[model samples]
Target chain A: MKGLKIIVLAKQVPDTRNVGKDAMKADGTVNRAALPAIFNPEDLNALEQALRIKDNYPGTTVTLLTMGPGRAAEIVREGMYRGADKGYLLTDRAFAGSDTLATSYAISCAIKKINFDLIIAGRQAIDGDTAQVGPQVAEKLGLPQVTYAEHVDKIVKNKITIQRRLERGIETVTAPLPCLITVNATAPECRPRNAKHLMKFKHAKTVTELQSAVEDYYKLHEDRPYLRIPELSVLDVEADTNWLGLAGSPTKVKAIENVVFAAKDAKQLTADQKDLDWLMGELVANHTLG
Target chain B: MNNIFVFCEIDEGKIADVSQELLTKGRSLANELKCNLEAIVIGSKLEGIESEIAPYGADTIFVADDKRLEFYLTLPFTTIIVDLFKKQQPQIALFGATSVGRDLGPRVSSALKSGLTADCTSLVIGNHEDKKEGKVYENLLYQIRPAFGGNIIATIINPDCRPQMATVREGVMKKEIINKNHKSKVVAIDVNKVVTDVDFAVEIIERHMEPRKIDIKKSQVIVSGGYGVGSRENFKLLYELAHVLGGEVGASRAAVDAGYVDHARQVGQTGVTVRPKLYIACGISGQVQHTAGMEESAMIISINTDPTAPITKIADYNITGDVSEVVPRLIEAYRKHSK
Candidate 1:
């Protein structure tokens, strides 16, 4: 029997957890460059899940995909160094400043160009924590989504069994294959980078990807392979131009505000009978209790 | 008139209480906008669910009932919600940031190609002068959420989208009073997706349902263990206290990681955020990331060996004593009081 085909969705994010002079701004948008860019921690956990399944199932091919600026090719290449059979980087100038909807539209377009038996993503991105893009991509792809997944327990021939962690407890559910899952950190920690695999993909850059390498080589040795990321036009991924990036995205930001959290000096609602009566009345009056 | 669309979360045929809380908030938002509020429930066997929503202030109930939706897999649920937005455009949409909701809200809004703000802590009506008169909203939708690790609040607006959406954390608001037989219209939207069109090949096997564990997020009373609880096994004191209070067991993320309980019960940035009525923090030194989740409790009491524990700063009452001793006493007090 052939192994499962798993594809992981990963994002390159500013390591916001790295607190330094460069992490925050005077106005509060993240100082993207102050912190080094790293693969999202949860997305790494997502990648690890795919790798573990491959290790257990054997014959599995794991593919990783991302859509971002050219720098994201490094994250995909890093995934390739982690046992991913192939990595697709959808790097283009047009995909910048995308909100969740626009980002999902672009990634979904990219996924359509590949065949996969399973799709996985982190539950939420660390920077935004909106937790929207994964499910949004699943919706655009018209796939079943099992979110807040903490562990993958068993796999029958065509049915997949897994544990979904909820606020209260865990629910074991069985569903058919070809679904999307957004995993949480409670899943297994990501495996460390492998050495041999890293060496194999170190030279695995596209022609465009190697262009920068040549420039850097010109600067240093001027002899080594010049590397530049492969920049895919919307046509390269077979994506409909009408439905990619901002043009295909429908949601638009109306405004953005910075809110300050100030603790209020609140009086306690007493447990006395008189206080209880007043509280009950207040609850009912406020439509909290009837 | 402007109408608010409330996404009422139903898990295993039961309506999640957080969605009811959202209805209460939505009702007020709808009133502030001077429009009707519709409670949207998607699931199978949803006949009596609408009866329980009206007291919370729903004027109309939208149901997308189907067997495929019996379990929440994003596809079927997101499709129905998008269909509703297309058919009956509402000015504002609100959802609970539960596992299902946090996943579903964005997908539906995006599918309809609209905007959504996630993990919102509050919402208000903005001036609708931007829209021409006779439009759905009196002004605009003001979506608010805690951003930057819950340190900063952000109010985001989607001026172009029909229904500006937000997903709020649980217990941030009080649940609306539901009148059993309030009169409301139930509209069934026929939203369907094919089984074969999905690209992700995932399978579901037997669900190894975790035996019923305490759900601290929904509990009105929580007996929580903190760092001073000493060891993971010492969490039994929290369970004893919770049993006496007829409440649920909870913990600081520290306690959960100290091997005191399963990670599912961890409460903090990466764990569940809860707002119970009475939160008893025993032996905890409250950090911002941890307190950000539980700060909204109705009444908070801090018990720590150290009088200067950070939790004491915000606690309504403080008991400075060893949690190993104080928790047992609190349990005894609850047991005697209840009996």
Candidate 2:
């Protein structure tokens, strides 16, 4: 069987799970500098699914695609260290302030330039948690989508079977190839970076990164073309400037407020026996507890 | 021409509670906007479903009953909803932020080239003034949700989109009946025109929907724990306390993510929003995401080692102690006092 080409979409998001005191600025904006960026948790799950397909199919190839600032190129190399064959950094100033719809349009335009039989992405990025980009991309491409996918059971005769994890129960379904899938976190965790792949890809840099680097690696990059990661700009994908960023986004933020909890007049207590007895007596008297 | 619409979700033969909640919310918004409230249900064997929806103050209900749509398939449902939205030109659209709604809302929004916000905690009708564009939009739907990991709350608005769409989680909005004898007009959609053979390309092979075993939403009292509870073994203490108090056990998103308990018992922004009468939080530091779910409880008792935990601010009673020690003693105290 001729192996299929797969594109795994990923995002470099602030580690929202471990937000510390410095994670937020005084004005209530996110302090991006204080938070370490990591590969979005579920996207790692999506990458694992892609790598598994590459493992099962001898000739299969996995390509990682992400759209963000120049720093997002780190995730592309991160994907290579795990098993992705190649990566693309879709970065441009024109793509700033894009909402989910505008972001998906830019991504769909980029995907059109690549050859792929399947597209896999995380169900949602933790930073946004909207879970809209994957399906929106599929809609823009006019492709079928299966969200909340837990596993890719098999691929036979251009047909793919997948297990989906839903709130109430499990569902197994089958769809033709060239479909988009947004994997859930329940999927197997991605394999750790391989020493060999890491050593090879550790030096890989995007064009923007190479331009800003102080070290002279131009000669080395020329000698080893694989070390140069391709950076696609808005013009490269031929996306209409009108549908690129804030201008194309339909939703606008009206207001933002820092969460402030109203303090209740709480009765203070301790772990002492007298306090515990008083608490129980008060609760039973008020019919709060039986 | 500009009506407020709710895409109702039906599980088995009954309309989901989240859908009813959205309908109740939609009715109030419609009343404020002075527009008719409409509902759309697409499923098979949906006869007489309007009776259930009319009590929520729906002025009109659209039914698209088809055997192929008995179970939700993404493409067909998206096709029908998008087509209806195009013809209806709804001013605002609301969906339950469920597995089905999350999947369908984005696809439909993308197809129609409209904007959609997900998992909003609040919805309000407000005006937006764009200083940059020198434009002012009147009565736009404000989609309020916790953003940046619940560190801040943002209100989103779609100024130019017709059918400003947003999905809200269940239990966040209170479901209320407008009148038991209210009447609503029913319109049958011709599904054959909207969906085609290609829409059913994906086929469900096997399905098993487990009956919900842990419904903490209905529990009057909930004994919840968080990551500060430490381990799965520590969660058993919470369960014991809950059992002794005749309440169900709940957990924070942190506790559930730590594998200390099932996701069903999770009480937080990402999990289930619970408003039990008596909520005893153990070892919960109570991030806004966790507190958003249970802060509305009639009474809150927080037990944490840190005296200044965020939960203490909203709790009616603050017990400064270790969960392990406090929970058992509370159980013992309750046993002695109740007897």
Candidate 3:
């Protein structure tokens, strides 16, 4: 079997599992600086699936692609430590404030410049929770897509079988190659970073970071191509300016409110049958259930 | 020319409840926008399905019935929907945020270059004032959903995009009844005009509907187990209690991660969000991830050894004891009282 060329779309999102009072600003925008940024939880799961394919097929290569600010390049380095071969950072001032549509447009533009057999991404980003970009990219690229993927069962002669985790059950289906898949968190947890790969790719930096670095690493990057993270701006990717950033985004935030749930005068119940019977009776009377 | 369109999902030759809920909401939204409320049904042999939608106030029902469109292959279904959207320009489109809808809605929205808000808890027809750009868009759908892991609610609006779209959460909105005598105009389109053989890129090998399908989100009552349940054997008690209560079994992420249960039963940020009428948390230490899914229940009851478990804080009724002991007694009481 020919080695598969896989591309994993990863994102650096705010750790939403932990939110504080300052997590949201007065204007309802995320207080990104206050919250620590980490690789999107499910994106790690996507990387694991890609890495597994590379492990099973000896010569397969895994590439990481992420679109965010300059700091988002950290995820690229992180992916490298976890067995990705190379990474691309799509960063530009014009890409700010883009919603799912424009975001996918920009990402698709970058993807068009690359060659790959399969594209994989997390089912949804924790920050937006839209689960649109992966499929949207597939549509733009005119490729078939499978979402809610839990496992890749097998690949033979350009057909890939996937087991999807749905809300109610599992569905195992097969799609032809050159397809896109958005993985679910139910997939296997990503393997930890390799010590040797970490030491090798630790100094990998995007052009924006290398420009501001005080230490001279240009010679080192020239010697080792893997230490250089490719950076693409809107111009480099040939994206339309009108479809780049806030202008390209159609969704607008109307308002935001902080909701705090507090129950008043909750009834206390013992573990005995008397209280259970009363509780069940109250539920029946209120038509909560029969 | 602009109308409100709701994608009426079909399950086992019947319209799904979530579709009716969207129709109910779509009716009011159409009234607000002074346009017609239409429904799109794509399936095989979808006769008599129009009645289920018309009563909910759909002005027109468009059906694209074909044998190939029966089980929802992504390519064919997406092609049909996208072709319809292009021909019929809608001001706003609504979809039930179920498995089929979630998979198809994005593909359609992207093909049309439209914006879609997913898993919206509430939706309203309103105006959007862009404070940053000093622009105002009148008659837009305000899509509201929980953000930051249910910590806050954000209202999203697609101002610049046409055919503003949203997928509503299941069981979030109330389905209402209108005049039963009213009938919607039924239009049947030829599927061959749009869908071609090339759409069938994905082949189905084996499709299996779960034998004991546990639908926690739609269940009226849910009995959820947590890590404190200890072992796989202990989860049997939860299933027994849930059986007596006529409720489905759910599990927290901890129990699922610990290999005590399958992912389908998980209730948390990463799992299914449920709003059952009665939610009984058994031996579950309520992490924010778990509570985010079930806290919306009408009544929350927690039974745990640790009284200070986070779930107890929000629970309407708190019981301090071992679940193994309390659950059996509760089951016995329910069995006796009902008999």
Best by DockQ: 2
lDDT per residue as tens, model 2, B197-247: 989989999998998677898776799999999999999999888866768
At residue A196, give the lDDT of candidate 3: 90
Clashing pairs in 2: none
lDDT of 2 by residue, A146-212 (tens): 9999999999998899999998899999998899999999999999999999988888998878889
Model 1 Cα lDDT, one tens digit per residue, B1-339: 347988988865678877888888887777777789998887777877877787787899988787656666665566567766777788788888887788778777777778888876557677543344454434676676655544344556676666788888765665657565578887776645423334224333334444446466776567778777888778888887665454678888888878888777777787788886567888879998788888887667777777777888888766666777667665544433321
lDDT of 1 at B169: 71
Candidate 1's residue-wise lDDT over A88-115, tens digit each?
7887656655678877888888888788
Candidate 1 C-alpha error for residue B70, in Å? 3.9
Candidate 3 local lDDT, B1-339, one digit each (tens): 688899999876789878998898899878878899999999998888888999999999999999877877888988988888888889898998888888888899999998898888777777767777898878788888877765677888888777899998666666777878779999998899888888988977766666446567777679999999998899999987776665789999999999999999999899999988689999999999999998888789899998888888889888888888889888766656441
Rank by TM-score, descending?
A: 2, 3, 1
Q: RMSD of each candidate?
A: 9.1, 9.2, 8.5
**Chain A TM-score per candidate?**
0.77, 0.87, 0.88
What is the two-chain DockQ of model 1? 0.23
Report the Cα lDDT for residue B119, model 2. Answer: 88
- Candidate 3 local lDDT, A55-95, one digit each (tens): 88888999999998888999999999999999999999898
> TM-scores across all candidates?
0.70, 0.80, 0.79
Q: List the DockQ of the predictions in order.
A: 0.23, 0.42, 0.37
